[model samples]
Target chain A: MESLFTWNFASEIVLSTFRMATPLLLVALAELYSERAGLVNIGLDGIMSFGALAGFMISYLTGNPFLGILAGALGGVLVNMVYAFCTVTLCAEQTVYGMALNIFAPAISAFIYRVYFGVSSTLAQATLMKTIAIPVLKDIPFIGPLLFNQTPMVYFAYLMVPFTAVFFNRTKAGLSYKSVGEYPKAAETLGINVVRQKYVACIICGLLAGIGGAYLTTCYVNTYSDGIVAGRGFIALSAVIFGHWTGSGVLMACLLFGFCDALQLKLQIISKDTPYQLFQMIPYVCTLAALAIMGAKKAGPKAKGKPYLREER
Target chain B: MKLGGKSENIIIPLIAVILAFLIGGVIIAALGSNPVDAVGYLVQGAFGSKTNIGATLVKVTPLIFTGLCACFAYRCGVFNLGGEGQFIMGAVTAVWVTVSWGLEGPLACAAALLLGAVAGGIWGAIPGILKVFRGLNEMIVSIMLNYVATLFMGWVYTELLRDGSVPQTFPVPDASKLGRLMPGMRATWGLVIAVLIAAGIYYFLFNTSKGFQLRAVGLNATASRYQGFNVKRYMLFSFIVSGAIAGLGGAIELVGTQFRLMSGFALGFGFDGVAIALIAQLNPLATVLVAYFFAVLRTGATTMQVGSGVPTSVIDIIQALVIIFAVAGMAFVRLPGFKQRMLNRQRGKKEE
Candidate 1:
């Protein structure tokens, strides 16, 4: 008597889930890349904020969302340079530098919003990233649009997941990067440019994480706000850890968490009497639970916070 | 090379603080603010009157707890990134205790402080235990728990503690509050508590067997394990203790400053504590000086904003810059043959 699959609501949930997962995928993959090289990106969250603001600002100024995305990525790299400076050069606590940068990003952006942008809601009519129809794929009925006919950036991000895995697993430098993470001392003895490799991974993280923030602002929300990044960098960090530093693993974790996030939002509309706050917290709570119950697989970097040094050179 | 240890560590931070402010002065000038007037305003705003000094002291109150929170785990070779969560839970637990029964003066204060630490310790231990038992990462655990604690705190405020008359919790009974220490300022006995906690942590960490175990673990976990020390147990203990210190910090803030539980009462102190701890290089005594300097910058920043056309956010920028400069070259003393390894890595990359 029951219809096999309701066309009305369930599909909408799936679509929203995919949409939500996109940014997380981009950012987590970014983390996977950088962390694999033994350098950590704590300011991924801050980079997201800076990207959102930069993307929104650029889109607003030029009336082009594509340009906005580029601007956003560049902005992220710019902010991350500060992180790279303290973490890589100064040999500071990566997490401490990261947390400070996170706090600093919002404060600076909020001030700029007040000072430069003033109190206007939404860069009102700033360009927004829209789905592009794949000519052949667009005509392939329902599943086509959901899968193929999506924003260019989303497709790019999805492609990046596997692309990154191949890069790390196949490329010569990628092997060196992994070696840098596992045994910096041995890798150094073998004459690998450990610090340079570390910088490369970190800078790439900056760019990809910037795109992730750009996706949130230009694609998902179409504007920026104070809590714009909203712990997504941390979420990306969680996804990377949950997936145990693998490319495909991070994608799966991102989708699962993002699905939970979308599902929690839908749960509130299921009935009137349910305590929505409890449901709202399910995604994060799930992240906490998953982090705890995921077992030995989620162990982190070997020489995580320690700076690589050579003989008293 | 043979300079006294304490003097150099302490003096380096002082110089860094001075240098950071000097840079901040340039930033103020760039923002079109007069440096002298801005400095004057900041000094007056943060410590000018009795009321201002009192507020500065109150603000400095929680920093001491967070300082201990960061320093404790850091000393043990495990970084406790969950200070914010611990602080929040401590404040929340304090509120619940105040509501349930009426305990006055020293007992109420003592109870609140202990419960605060316990709550923080437990919160902190979650990550530490995960790190030790399941082989799960502590950084991820601590990071996620922070959001959980914050949201949970927000929920408790909205659901259970909300006075219904306002968006925040109802005030604690007069007896639950630590009495004010000054006539003109809101500073209370909380400052004294903060001081005592810092001093106690310093004495315990630098002078005791427990401190040596933690330092040994931090210096080399494998070596400590070789020495038959339970690295995991101490990591858990110190992390929990650190969380407790931070938790007690949140309770003090509630009792001394806010007098009621509010969402985000602990604010950015937990994160700021990391900066303080780093600047102090995990030295317990150095934490006091760093906390005070940060407190002055924060308290005076508002005045800087008002007096100069510059935004107070320049303080945050300066804070970041300070961390960059502070941790510089700490790796200078690492390993017996660090340079040879560094050069090899560089050469390997070049050949590839």
Candidate 2:
């Protein structure tokens, strides 16, 4: 098996990195729509937390992993619905409401978990999805099985890239959505339902982010743990910004991060260049550096934080 | 633009408090706990018994410091998440200094506080310098620093500062221990010191020329720079002070209450103070009330659990709900009605 080539190592890194980046990619794409319309979904962390809980709970109950992913996505949407209703409809401060939702997330999820599984010292693990290798691709040495083989969720993640790309670039509605993000007043003047478009965008962010959370629980960890979402959502947010709000850009950034995180883990195991925790800090620090660098590079949305009012200046 | 002097701004905050408590009561009831009994236990546990009250005050002492850390940044439109890390580093550095030197009570405390402040100041200055020199955003940098600080503290606990005696550092010598407030409560004079610090910060922030410049820079840094002030330097100094204040909070918690640093010993303490700062709407004086309220909720969660068989998670739920409502600005009434008649009359008298 010629999987030992330097390029093979690099290609293999991208392959597995895709698996790791799937959840963040999905969530970042979700955020791309809402953020474009001047809303920040800081509660994406909470949403992922709740989604992980929901996904795990549903999978444990139904014994079917697909439905679990759906439930997780729905769970994310439910929280985002609260966020959307508060910030978009009730005209609350988006940041505050979003942060509060982040707080509310673990509180609610833990409360419910305690209610259902009271006094249990440990949680029961759920069923994990098996990796399916394509028949012909399975025999192609290192490149074949490695590239073609993965769980259903992994393929779904790849599908989402082109799906979102097409949705954003090729569709008339996508242009209308971008118009709302760019200038809601102008969009409204041209007869687009600016408020509706924003609501749709926020809802989509919620749904996809939930699926992202599900991917973490079912495909990766396969069991729920305290603070299981960890800091992945923040890493994903960094990816989105690094990607410059484009689908390919987000995926590539996430792959870079996944490689950094994975390489850190692997490197710490082999060498004593730095402690594992110190190496772990690299990903977050890189996020900060990337954000600062990008801030100086180019302009993003014209209206990022300003809420558009149909009647007001 | 006048906004009816400074007194009117107080109403929205007052309303936020009343609404938070009333909703908190409902939450307890929904959890199958008697709201009255929950409040009773909270009061009794926190204040009715002298020992518990002292414990509460001791807890509040450090929280007050962290709360002020957040309060300073809000006046400048920046939210700092690195307080937790900064606070822990402050404690570690202070404890290390205390062990290195043998001094009596007040001298050791002062030395520890100063050293801790400088440690926190340096750590906090990283983001500050980045924001000033490299045009970095403080919010992202602060969040990143939080992880770094937390990991650094965790590393200290495990490697450099590990103690075999117990899970924490060795007992600070009697000379290093903060003196008690009175004979009864285990609460130390840290409360008094915290109050003094708060008053000092209040005067510095509300009255001093430096405080005014910081606030001006916070309100609009570019405009302030155009007026020929050292905007970046002031901004950098702002984080140094904020981080120092937060560091002192950690020192107080360790020296006054905990007496040794350990894992999860002060878990969520810094973030709790952040919630208090927000609920207090960046008012240093009001931070006491908000911090106390949260402390009581944390103290009372146990009793609420024992009494009604409700999971203690309900208290967390209530705290989250209160934060949600506060941040959403849901509790604020932009328009004041006849309901605030008594407050209006009191303000009317104050204006004279």
RMSD of each: 5.2, 4.6
On residues B293-330, what C-alpha lDDT tens digit does candidate 2 reach at each position?
77776666665566556677777777876776665553
lDDT score, residue B290, model 2?
77
lDDT of 2 by residue, A25-109 (tens): 7778777777777677777878988888899889889887888899899999898988887677656666666666667887788
Task: Please name the candidate that would achieve the greatest DockQ relative to the true structure.
Answer: 1
DockQ of each: 0.45, 0.44
For B177-230, candidate 1 gives per-residue lDDT tens digits of 878886777878888878887888888877999888889998999999999999
In model 2, which runs have C-alpha deviations exceeding 4 angstroms?
A: A1-16, A134-141, A271-275, A292-298, B1-32, B100-106, B165-168, B221-230, B330-352
lDDT minimum window of 10 residues, candidate 1 chain A = A1-10
Q: Candidates' TM-scores?
A: 0.90, 0.88
Backbone Cα, N, C clashes tallied per candidate: 14, 0
Which number leads on lDDT? 1
Q: Report the TM-score of candidate 2, chain A only.
A: 0.90
User: What is each model's TM-score for chain A?
Assistant: 0.92, 0.90
